[model samples]
Target: MGYLICILLYIAGIIIYGIVMGKKKVKTSDDFVVAGRQLPFMILIGTLLASWCGGGGITGSASVVYLYGPVVGTLHFAGAPIGMLLLYFISSKVRSSTKITVPEVFAARYGDGASIIAVICIMLAYVGLCATQIKAAGNIISLITGMDANLATVLSAVGILLLTVSGGMISVAYTDAVSALLMVGGFLLAIPLLIGRAGGWSEAMAAIPAERLTGTGGLGVIAILGYMIPTISLLLGDQNMMQRFASAKSAEEAKKSNLGLFAAEITVCVLIILMCTIGIALFPSLDVPSNIIFSLAVNYLPFVLGAIVLVACVAFIVTTADSYLLSAATNVTYDVWGKYLNKNADDKQKIHFMRITILVLTVLAVVLTLFFPTILSLQMTAYTMYGAAITPALLFALFSKKVTKAGGIAGILTGGVVTVVWTMVLNSPYGIASAIVAVPAAVVVILLVSALTGFKGEETYRRLYENSKS
Candidate 1:
């Protein structure tokens, strides 16, 4: 009952914070979408950290550590921080761009056709990503309160929707900042307690599977690369990351925020690895690996410590869900409705449309959660879908002058189609991830098509790629 009370308090606090911030900070569509372009360095870092380190980082990575051990798990998860480091190089350019959505970025460089394709891919990918968070939240709540999982899922989705619909980016970013702190603090407190309860570091090490202790965790290079590439690609082109960059006060703040984000990301990755490793040592055989972290918190730690960790985990999942939910809705508002359906939409109409889209997308995400069997599978699929479909074209637009509009459209279409075929139709043939095949295919197509078509958007390319240098 105490645990339930704590979780409820945390939820109530976040909802209240989101509502209050929404009323105070969110007035125009610009404010709702990008926080009036005034986010400071620390808040930028916090939002980035909390948004990226969602269900995938907490539950999905925990499952990997439980199965593969710490070494391989850490390597598998390293793609995110590595991607953040790579994004750091281009943070200034990303921030300098006036575009809000990834689709808008495509439209600026590749034309409207590419923008339409991008909206399709983003909606497909982000809905799934949002669903993963909902699924994780449901699992956490169910475990904490002994509630029915489906009912818990509905409640979790409601919480995300309420928070997201309240203030858009303003609510999402500020709540994300708070969640990031709680997430790190909880993990910091839980790690030592978990390891100590498992009979200390040495004894815990003794109990882990020998294969898990090895560098590869017996998964080998090909499999590890499969896991790593999609995350890297996703981060490189994630709409949530791009939106946060757009929210920063200036390019310099955006660049500096990347450094803070990298530090926070690495900290979370290491802490999760240690906690999951301890979980493996204590519970050598569990029916569900994803539940390892929650299991440790509920069954092993003391009441206070367990409640803190649980609240932190909930914060991670809830913040991520709302971030993606809001981001996907932004893609619709800016790229689809505002761009095509209602070119003359006022600030009031745009905000209303965005809020309505959020509610619709929330329903879509809840439906999607029923399709995937596990958080990891859904996570990889969503990551690969967005990464392959958008990242190749996006990175080319950002860095290359030779890319043609024809090439960009072809790349986005090919990447999205191939991912669907590979994962949904062929069932990820031979146990390989779609990213292993789809990303390279998209890149190759982009290069070949651009070479054939000749450059057409040189001026736009200069604006996006060269002018930002000034």
Candidate 2:
């Protein structure tokens, strides 16, 4: 009952926030979509962290920490930071570019055909990413409150939908920062209490599995790196991250936000690792791996603190759902509808189209929850497809002057097709990281194709590129 009350209050608070942000009278496509390109550093940093913190950052990381112990947890956390730093480099480029969205970068660099491919990859990939959070929320609510699984699932879905549709990105960014703060505070405050309850550090250490406790991820260094490569690659191309980059008030603001995000990632990941380590020592036999973090909070903390932490987790997931839905909506409206459906549509009509796309994407995300049985069972192909296909070309184009449109196109297609076939179709041979394999494969194709075709940059991009250098 306490958990349910906390969750309901949180939902009410979010809806009210939505109503407020929507009242601003969106005037331009930039106004409706990216808040007129005026997001400051603090909010950008917060929104970026909030989007990633989701069920996976708290619950999933905690769960993995508890089961695999500190070493593997540390490795995974360390691996994720690589993606953040990569984003730092990529954002420096992406933020300065004359592009509005990922596909715009594609079209600006390659052509219309490339833009279409970019849109397809982002839409397909983002839903799977969003669904993972939905599944996590369903599992979290079901475990903590002892509600009927089906009822919990539907209720959680509605919560995500309401929050997502509320004010779109504007709502998502501000609310996410608030949620991230709460989640950090909740975890930090609860840790000592949890540790005291578990007896002491030595006792907690005694409780964990030996293999899970130490060395190159117990799953081997190669295997762990395999899982991380794609995420690392994603720093360059992930729309969620890129949109935030574009949303920053300036290129320097974007770079600063990425730096701050790195700090938050380290701090929050450590907090979560501690909670998970402590939970491992405190609990009895654990059944669901994903439920470990929430289970620990419910089992140990006093009602007030537990409820605060519970809301934090819910906020994380809710903000993630909203962020993803907004990103997916942009791909359609900006990349597809605004460009093709009504190329000459005014800012007002484009804003209208974006709002409709947000609602449509949210509906689809809700419906998607019905199919996947487990949160982890929800396809990560969304991650792989976009990360593998679009990320490589974008990163290289930013760093290497030699990269041509032909190379960019070759890389996008090669990365996209090979990653899908390797991870999904051919089963990612030899257990290599799909990204390790995917990036090099795309790079090879890009190099080969560019060499064959003698591609060059267009005048619009050339002028922008020259201006930036000048």
Top-TM-score structure, candidate number:
1
Instruction: Give the CA lDDT, 0 to 100, for residue 309 in model 1.
Output: 88
Where is model 2 more than 4 Å wrong at Cα? 370-373, 377-380, 428-430, 458-470
Find the candidate with the highest lDDT and give its number.
Answer: 1
lDDT of 2 by residue, 18-110 (tens): 768866734566765676667878889889999876876765556657667788778766766878876777776777776667887777667
> Tell me, what's the RMSD of every candidate?
1.5, 2.4
TM value for model 1: 0.97
Worst 10 residues of 2 by lDDT: 461-470
Give each model's clash number. Answer: 0, 0
TM-scores of the candidates in the order shown: 0.97, 0.93
lDDT of 1 by residue, 80-193 (tens): 989999999877778887777888889888989999999999999999999999999899888877899889899999988998998888888888888888888988888888
